[model samples]
Target: MSANTPMLITFVIYIAAMVLIGLFAYLRTRNFSDYILGGRSLGSFVTALSAGASDMSGWLLMGLPGAIYLSGLSESWIAIGLIAGAWLNWLFVAGRLRVQTEHNGNALTLPDYFTTRFEDNSRILRVFSALVILVFFTIYCASGIVAGARLFESTFGMSYETALWAGAAATIAYTFVGGFLAVSWTDTVQATLMIFALILTPIVVMLATGGVDTTFLAIEANDPTNFDMLKGASFVGVISLLAWGLGYFGQPHILARFMAADSVKSIPAARRISMTWMILCLGGAVAVGFFGIAYFSANPDVAGAVSENPERVFIELAKLLFNPWIAGVLLSAILAAVMSTLSCQLLVCSSALTEDFYKAFLRKGASQRELVWVGRGMVLLISVIAIIVARDPESKVLGLVSYAWAGFGAAFGPVVIFSLVWKGMTRNGALAGMLVGAVTVVLWKQYVGLGLYEIIPGFIFASLAILIFSKIGSGPTAGMLERFDAAEKEYQDAHL
Candidate 1:
């Protein structure tokens, strides 16, 4: 048999299983809510793993490792920042979002929450927030597609376009059929595959380099600077890397995991589980890249795949170190990462269009059955757009991820923070904050040459905008305040 046969078989099996899960979820999806948000019935295990799975995406396997492989330990600063940011997001945002989303008209989408949170009868908040989701998520989805394309191209020796569509096919299949429930459940399975691959790959790499001690020696021989976290660091560069954590607040896909939890009471357990998985997986990714330096340095003749594109470090290493059967499973982990995040993103985009745009304006009295079909249609629509965006074979996963991450973080992070905590936050305040945050990120990214990441300025400006606008504009109405108070009370009650 050809060397690629086992890998091909493994890939086919994984995709088939995901589609079967989607079929199962489809049978249980009785309404639009279940289709989009799993009817808010996810348990702690599903919620925790799904959130982590969706948040990490293909970047965990491809982009972050690549960055570390290219620049050494300094790149690990991004991982540290993510740990801090994810912890804070879980502690402050998860439970509150779960409860607040429920209390305020049982909001199934962020746009739905915003509309009811401040009682925005004009529906401006719903329209704008949905637009923001669609815009940034399209770019975000493209990053996942790019990562998938790279995987297929490297493994099967296919062209970029062929790999792109081939990689996207299964994801679209399961996601289109099953919706949120399928995405979440499949994410749980995918999360397990991802962690296993990350942990085992690094160990194999360490062994291939002789041993831990020998690996370090080889790394030192290659360039001792690889061990220094501050080897070529700048203040702005470090801060920019860390700022990735902030994006967690505004991530529609990750936040969906929080909202779909069975109850706010599930949050503490879920948070604990999520952080543990995240830290281990992140540590493993760092190890893979760091140790890969030694392996590649020692075997420069076989380093062409990774040398050409650092993102393929993990893929190249897996193929080289493991037997064909084991390598197939390891490679499937990359697909797991890609599918988990891409499915959630597609579902979120569909929700924004179906629940926020279609139902809100186009068909206020549409049947639940009709809405589910509409959501599925929107999923196809967004995937095509994302595919177009990802057509450029030169696109880098990390670069694409960073831009969309900044856009969402700067635009929605402050707004989510202020809205949940402060009853005083008015609709105009949210509008202003979203505008300032998004605009600041875009302007800073395009025009500013400063060493700072755009999220820093965008977040700062957005927070100020919320405070200033809330003070100047009329405060939230009596009904909005009552809902906020009730949600807060419920949150305190849950903890107690």
Candidate 2:
């Protein structure tokens, strides 16, 4: 038997528990609302944790750590930008999105909300938005799958393909069965586990390497760039990279939480809880990476042992620092980070397909029972496709996530923000913004050799599209303008 057998067993048990929780959630699902939004009954804590867990995902473990290891303190700016963006999203977008969605009789997905908001009864906007959701979400889901594959490969010595499928299947089973409730509940648990892992691992690694002072001194002596926030080799690149926080405005998975939130009043609490969790968790992850550098430096042999795969920084630390039992649990925490995210993305994408497209256009007469089946079917399909894409093993989690994030941010971010804040935002303007934003991201990623990240160009084009299209295209209809004004007034009064 492999020496890591105990850790492997723990991971298996963790996967089983997640699937069972999903099954439990599935059993309670009696209707579409229950499956999609948990009947809008989620409290602030559940909503907050779920949102933060899903948002952070593998990026927190792999991307953030890798950044700190390779770059340094500059990586923290990404966390700073994200924290500020999240706080503002909760403060501004959450309450109004929730109230307006319910008022508009849209209970399902982001595209559905857009359709109802602009009174796009013609279904053109719905179809276009659904297409964007599916395309970008497929790529987004692929990134999470890559992270899961990496976790399995690093910990269990499993083949990437085998781990990829196992991770995908486990998340799909739960998400398909339990829907939103299962996703949120499991996310909350996973978030707690992740926090524990982040906090505990760093402290232990630091102690094992003598102490923080000794460790920091070693890092400084070994590589001065490791301590310099700006002069760090990839500092500016990382900051430009982390500033991708602006993409939060349009992310369907994140914003959907706002829509399904119980009330605007609950939003502030959720915001506080989520931001605190992110700051601590993300900060800990960065610390883990930087500390891993010092720990490995103290024992150069351990660094050579896992030389080929720097992404396995956390896994290597687990084996070096903990007993089999604790390592087992820590392994599960990594899985939690990966799976928590995959489950949420799968649900959001499935909801977009079933509610926004299938029900809206393809099968208008489909019953709730049939729609539930359709959602399950879509979840299965997306999981398979993501697994196929993940087979390449070369697509870095951070890169894939960045592309998908920028695409969604460009396509939907400006449109959503303007729709909520600008009464003059027209259907034509929204459509132009969506198309321009999405296309700009794709083109910039593909053809632009400018060397800057695609997100910078994407955001610029997206913002421009919204501004120009809103000005040049037909203005908002009179009735739509009136509704916007009323919604704005209500938002102001409620906050005031």
Candidate 3:
């Protein structure tokens, strides 16, 4: 219809493929478990890719790049922190959580896991954790929506309002149809596209500017601090940036990949694959940002829009450097990164609604088929809410993401780590840790106004709360401690 016809067509075909994958998954989904966790049947590669895709989100393509574009190498500490956190998560939390969740009441969701893990008969853990997830994930999902909106608006010449809703349509359709299986399979494909795009774009941009040496000349001439990793960096800033890795221990969507793995033996392989992919993808993302400084500096006319909105660096570069078809595919990779995570978040929210709230509180005997439809319905509902939340054209993807990441990291990170290792963790302690972690994050962000990131304080306070409350409140019963030991033994035995 216009000059953007090819890109639009590429996007259409990609979106259609995602929907078809969902339909295929729909056929295989036999019960609620299959819909929520894909019957715990994912292999190592799929598990790794899905986890990476979901965890990285549009932050990988847009937010991270934008940060580097604006702030230079100093912004890269976030990536380093994320990589370290991801490695630790895979190493310490993955296999143990997989074995423990399966043994501890076969929990289907994070809230369910918290409830069963602590043996809380009162259901406070389920309700509170579910509420926390719904609150933060709604914001998290909105960030993904904002990323998609930016992609569509930049790539197709659409208004932000139209792009916002349009971007969510395909993600909701596929997630509503296929459930977890569809999300995972589509995530695998999207992950490959994202990696290819990130790798190819940076290589092209680097060559276009002559080479690394020439690119550095351009960047340094334009702004010297772009090369200085420690320029204007403070001790507090460095610690705050590095603390992002702590978020990994409590990310429900990433942890879901571990829960859905076909077996504990699959974890080590999955972890290796995931870390390798993460390193490559994160490096590529940072390269795009760093090289963008050189590319834009050399071409001021083309950099007009990007200078104003740094987040558009990736999209603008693809358009300027590549032919229409190639750019379409590259832009599709941005869409891939956005959709992959949004769909996973929506599905996880759906599971929380269906399994955690709907069934837990209402319609206790709902059939598997009915539950499946309800999950689908919630997926649509949550997507609409996220769309509404993303209506602010001024919303920064990274800003929203940082808040939600801190919320989850502070609320659940310390509690998750302690619960997994410390058999003495009581229900009151878990509750105290979650409440203190979440509340402190809020207060620190809103009131403290300390230049430091909230997660640093929130995480520390939460860990202290758990330790203190565990001592003051009733400790875990002997039976619960025995079960914890048994699960720990089973995990170690399998690894051996």
RMSD (Å) of each candidate, 1 decimal = 1.4, 2.2, 1.6
Candidate 3 structure quality by residue, lDDT tens digits, 1-496: 6658878888999899999999999999999999999999999999999999988777788889999999899999989999999999999999988988988889989899989888899999999999898888888889888878878887777999899888998889889989999999999999999999999999999999999899989989989999899878998888888999999888889889999999999999999999999999999999999999999988888888888889888988988899877888888998999899898899889999999999999999999999999999999889888888799856564365667889899999999889888988898899999999999998999899568889888999999999999898577888788779989998999889
Writing each residue's lDDT as its tens digit, candidate 2 over 93-180 gives 7888877677555547777877767777687878888888887778778888888887877677789878888778788889988998
A best-first ranking of the candidates according to their TM-score comes to 1, 3, 2
CA-lDDT, candidates in order: 0.92, 0.81, 0.90
**TM-score for predicted model 2 compared with the true structure:** 0.94
**Native-referenced Cα lDDT, model 2:** 0.81
Candidate 1 residue-wise lDDT, 1-496, digit = tens: 9999999999989889999999999999999999998999999999999999998888898888998999899899999999999999999999999999999999999999999998889999999999999988888888888889988998999999899999999999999999999999999999999999999999989999899899999988888898999978998898888988998898888888999999999999999999999999999999999999999999999999899999889998998999988999999999999999899999999999999999999999999999999999999999999898899956554365667888888888999999889989999899999999999998988899498989999999999999998999577788898989999999999999
lDDT value, candidate 3, whole model: 0.90
For model 3, give the 10-residue run with minimal summed lDDT: 393-402
lDDT for 171 (candidate 2): 86
**Against the true structure, whose lDDT is highest?**
1
Q: Give the Å error, residue 381, model 1.
A: 1.1
Q: What is the lDDT of residue 241 in candidate 2?
A: 57
